[model samples]
Target: MTNAVFHWPVSSLVQITDCHLLATPDALYQGIKPYHHLRLVLDELRAEAPLLILTGDLTEDHSADSYTLLQQLLADWPAPVFLLPGNHDERGALDQLSQQPPFRPERRLALPGWQLWLLDSKGDTPAGSFPVPRLAELECWLNEAGHQQIFWFCHHHLLPVGSFIDRFDQQDKAGLLAMLKREPRLRGLAHGHCHHAYQYDLPEFVQVGCPASSVQFLQTPDWQTQDQGPRACRWVFTPDGRLQWEFLQF
Candidate 1:
């Protein structure tokens, strides 16, 4: 994992998640061309961002070609890109991206006064899971983080978002939340899986759901599509441990 510390008084990060790109550029998923939509989202981000995080579900078909396509798409991006896996992503296919520059596989990132933990919640099924080993590692990191505020990034939601996707929330959420609660340094959590934007304020931290770059899922109880427009999330972190975020929809 890369452990470089930023010295800037303020740092910004752009999160583009659940791209669901297919193997071919011309392919379509859910009646929308994911590649085209991703292109549109990337174009909208013409401004420079210090860091970019792709939460998960990067490919719809779990093809190496898709990862290669993603690598090519972000080849010229001005900032570093950190990636984690979703239930749909294949580790072997995703690892190919780490071999290249600008595409990082690091799960832990350190900012000036905050630490970002990109946890892997991908499980055997669609629901998320934080295994015992991974949880132990995170606990260790929390202990080592000292007094710095922590922000978690994962692929699945820990809390229900009033949608049908709530059934697929992380199975080990209780354990994870317990660990996080014990650490007063946890400030926020960000995830992308339900394919919509929402926020929930917990006692110790706030959880923000990132919108999908390819499509946005409806908040209805069942799996339904109301909007296919692409979206992204921008996060600003201040040196004093404050986080501000907004959604960019197209």
Candidate 2:
């Protein structure tokens, strides 16, 4: 329910997704030390980007210690950070850190020319879909915006890109897509969870599926591993609502 206002808010933003950090640095997920990978990429992304959007799935174990560790890790980064929740994340765990700076619980975030709708898409199972209440609120927002540009960020993907992640991807993608199709002001949408880096164009907007900052999926069913470089995404927005983006993998 809070609105973030800046005297001269910059339009450029950097998105780091699916960190999946653990309680300990030595702990591993899917044969990869997620903490090690996240740290490596975070060190390199300490550039002049004005905003940082951490899409979701911040912890693999849902440990409070892991969230604390993440907070300490980004304490001094130059840009303001926005944290969105992923399916693996627990809302109570994230809410405990809500009072801290750059650790926000806001569903809607405003930028100079864009309104980032950080939706709550987590369902009862790992595969996420918004609840009826949250869905209603989202629909209202989409209907109310007059001419403001928007960039929707969430934890799951709307389209299945031939990846095995379809099992845990968005369950209500059709409803979500229908909303987007109705809105011409939507500039783009960003997400994590598949651990793959790819972009697709929707007739009037763009969709960016960010790779995990920790690891990636080789293919399907067995959940095999392939060497996926830890990655981050960047978007530079102009006052007039034009956005250009790039993905950085390391």
Candidate 3:
């Protein structure tokens, strides 16, 4: 994976995930018009104007036309945009956006004092998995990074959030957790797919779930809707390696 280094005046990023947009503009998912909701969220995010990280499930139909729609939606965005895949996304279809501006496929981003590692946790099933090759690559990247503060962005939650969605959590959690425990420089991890905004203050790092830009799911034993409109997550990186974040509701 290529690494892109940016020396920005401000160390901030916006994460908008799980858009689940369809090819048709007015199509609805779970009674929510995803395209309309995502447009509203993007409009609200225009003021922040940070490096945008879209954490996956970009298309519900996994169609090229759906990706084309996403491309059009973000065509005029001013800042850099990074994208990852979710269970509902097709890698080939998503990669086509990389040929254009604002849609970057680079997995590693180098900030001033921090390194952002965007991992692809989309596996065969709804649950996530880190195959041997991916784990080895990550291990090498972590070692080469050499004490730089690290932050991870992926589509699957690394840990359970006490809900039915837990069944779809990353399948190789222990392997990832082991790596996190050994890497003291790792500061935080942000993910989507839960469609709910929550945090876990681990001894090694802070893990946060990004709210969906399309719709949200209630965090309960059984699946339910969280009709709080569309949302996003904004993360600020301090010079001292501390991280602060908040949810953006539209």
| Every model's TM-score | 0.94, 0.90, 0.95
If both were scored by lDDT, which would come out higher, candidate 1 or candidate 3? 3
Report the lDDT tens digits of candidate 2 across residue range 141-238.
Answer: 86765577877888888877675788888897777777778877877688888788888986777888887888877666657666576888887767
User: Between which residue pairs do clashes occur in model 3?
Assistant: none
lDDT of 1 by residue, 1-250 (tens): 4443333333788888999999999998888889988988887786754578898899998888888889888898877788888999987766778657787767777777888888888999989988898888887787778888889999999878998999899998888888767778888799999998889888888989999988788989889865558899999877688889998888
Best by TM-score: 3
Candidate 3, residue 241: lDDT: 80
Instruction: After superposing candidate 3 on the true structure, give the runs of residues whose Cα lies further than 4 Å from its correct spot.
Output: 1-9
Error of 3 at 48 (Å): 3.0
Those runs of model 1 whose alpha carbons end farther than 4 Å from true positions after fitting are 1-10
Question: Which candidate gets the maximum lDDT versus the true structure?
Answer: 3
lDDT of 3 by residue, 1-250 (tens): 3454444456788999999999889998889899999999888877767789999899998877788889989998989898899999987777768657887768887776788889999999989888888989888888778667889999999888989999998998888888888878887689999999989998888889999998889878998976689999998887678888999898
Per-prediction CA RMSD (Å): 1.9, 2.2, 1.5
Q: Write down the lDDT that model 2 would get.
A: 0.77
